[model samples]
Target: MPNIQFFALAESVCKKLNLPPIPFPVRKGRDEIIFNPQGVALDLLLDELEQYLIEKPEEKIFYKDAFSRLAAIEGIRLGEEGFHDHAAHYFELGLALDPANLALRSNYALSLQSAGRKEEAMRQYRFLLQQPVISGQCLVLIPAARLFLDCGDPVTAHQIVKHCASFMPVDNEFWDLFAEARQRCGIKRWMAPRQKQQEIMRQATAPDYKSAPTGKKKNFCPACGNRLKPGARFCGGCGHAL
Candidate 1:
């Protein structure tokens, strides 16, 4: 996966060290639209970042900020062209930066959803909604709602939309989605329920007739009601070897 945003932590460290800013989602052999952070500068920054982490374990905010920025870059990449590599990398950074940050977690969930990792993304959303801090912000709420809808869990989607009801206006996209959410919620009820499939029994023996005194008689296997031989070691009609 090619991430468009390079490590902002690395970029920040390099900038402080008076090095060139390396952008992310490195496109090899193409014109460097973003900064590249692979050579000596990258090495130095990585070493420094590790050392910094060791030296000051309390600077959680700084690390979190770096990750949040990286996640934002991922969201941008998703909007631009729905690139999973860039999206997933940024999401990892965001979660790594601040695991407690529901916003970051939510964003990462959306990234995973866009990347076709529905269950993983749904897990993240469920975790995020469990937190007492979840609110109706579009960035967080919209994607969460979308994920629920996509998962055939429209009930949850409706709850999310209703929770954000105050935030919606007449022309807002949420209003349309709210309606969709309702429709999705009731979709199963309106549609005819699917019938259960019964197992088909295979024939144990082929059809055969027996010559009885009064009339022709038939002996069939109980499993498939197929014809069978009387007192034979095997069923010649259907090859049911006794």
Candidate 2:
């Protein structure tokens, strides 16, 4: 359910490319993201927080709430640990803080789908579709339709894309998305060079760009030439501020 940007960044990570990585939604409640975390560390933080929430149980957790931000941060870390259940826990916590939060809802839905609750995932997507004041972020819709197709209802999936094609913007990015949706719907002809370009763009902005070295000795941030290893005010040599 994350925006196209999130998936695109994930795809980039999957392909080991470096560019503008997709971002996890950061607008969730304070209980969602844990920034500048120190001695608590990643491993024990979630456990401790879970216990804390249990004993104190407050009302209306949202992005502004400290606990909610921490929960979001830990949730992302849990996801990286391949602990899908824990990941869902934090995502839900994030949603609890901000129910109408498209980012959390979308991501939680994807986690459900990935965890093999296909029907539940589709139900979430349907709910997202029914939002009358939705943003122009068609990324969530396109991917969900593909999921439906893979779940053995090409007819419904086809309808999904056909109805959404109008919502799609006029650009190569969306054209590629349509191409992919059509291909998922059994329109083999949509698999063309444009779609290939889209795939390339997806690869470009994936997560963990440094997982595989980019054949460069120095891992300077290409954007600002900032030396990445920390403890420096700027690039000691390039003067790019850290």
Candidate 3:
């Protein structure tokens, strides 16, 4: 109904994995295929594909797109099942085959974050931000801002959202994070019209700001904004180890 190509592929995968074929019932209309989410054993198929990829790494370049799709699906399934580390592993494998796949990259970064691998998550987000297509996507911007805020970089979070504002209307989530960033950066939102107007005027008339004095910079957790105790190897707030 809805393109039975993957169905055949799934059957082949089952054979390769030495598993029984999925008994997909024959349906009358295309709508049945569209509505049935569990019509296939996607997770099992993906597991088989992962094993196949592992044993036949040379075939990855030839079957990159298929492998990437399977990996993405499996990663999402594992993440939904509360297996974040496994999810991250699959996502990483997917990204390795198709580095330009932003969706896979986003999912992988999210999995890394969920798995308490904050530094690695930040690195992936930063890499995504540098990509022209990804930099403009709100999906990437929102999470990157959140990560930056959590990592004690509200200034960076604010800057990222502010840049996004020029291209797209800010959503509620963006505004919420923006408010948090402002608060954390020692700024307050004005409720009064007069105060708001005065603040705007001040900003318009203020002289150019000078750089702060150079000193030893404080270290903060990449996972949470808690100040890192000297020589500490983990985040106290989120339990993310360095």
TM-score of 1: 0.48
Task: Using lDDT, rank the candidates from best to worst.
Answer: 3, 1, 2
For each candidate, the alpha-carbon lDDT, in order, equals 0.60, 0.59, 0.73
How well does each candidate superpose onto the true structure, as a TM-score?
0.48, 0.47, 0.58
Clash count of each predicted structure: 7, 24, 0
Q: How accurate is candidate 1 locally (lDDT)?
A: 0.60
**What value does the lDDT take at residue 120 in candidate 2?**
80
| CA lDDT, candidate 2, residue 1 | 20
Q: Give the distance in Å from residue 75's predicted Cα in candidate 2 to where it truly belongs.
A: 2.6
User: Candidate 2 overall Cα lDDT vs. reference?
Assistant: 0.59
lDDT of 3 by residue, 1-242 (tens): 23322234366655664444433222234334433566655555455555555666786766677667768878988999999999999899888889988899999998888898989999998888788877678877878889889998888888787787676453656666766777888787623334457889999999988987899999999877899899998888888998
Sort the candidates on TM-score, descending order.
3, 1, 2
Report the lDDT tens digits of candidate 1 across residue range 1-242: 23222344355564654433433222243323233454333323333343444555675555545435545544555546868656666566656756776666766777788788889888888888888777645577777887788778889998997788776444446666777888877753221111111112223353446665675676776555667767866666566655
| Winner by lDDT between candidate 3 and candidate 2 | 3
What's model 2's TM-score? 0.47
Over 1-242, each residue of candidate 2 has an lDDT whose tens digit, in order, gives 22111112245442442223323232224223333343224333334445444543562342124444555566666667777677777778767656777767777777777677788889888888787654345667667777877787766666666666776455565455556557666777664456678889988887764565466566675656656775555566666755
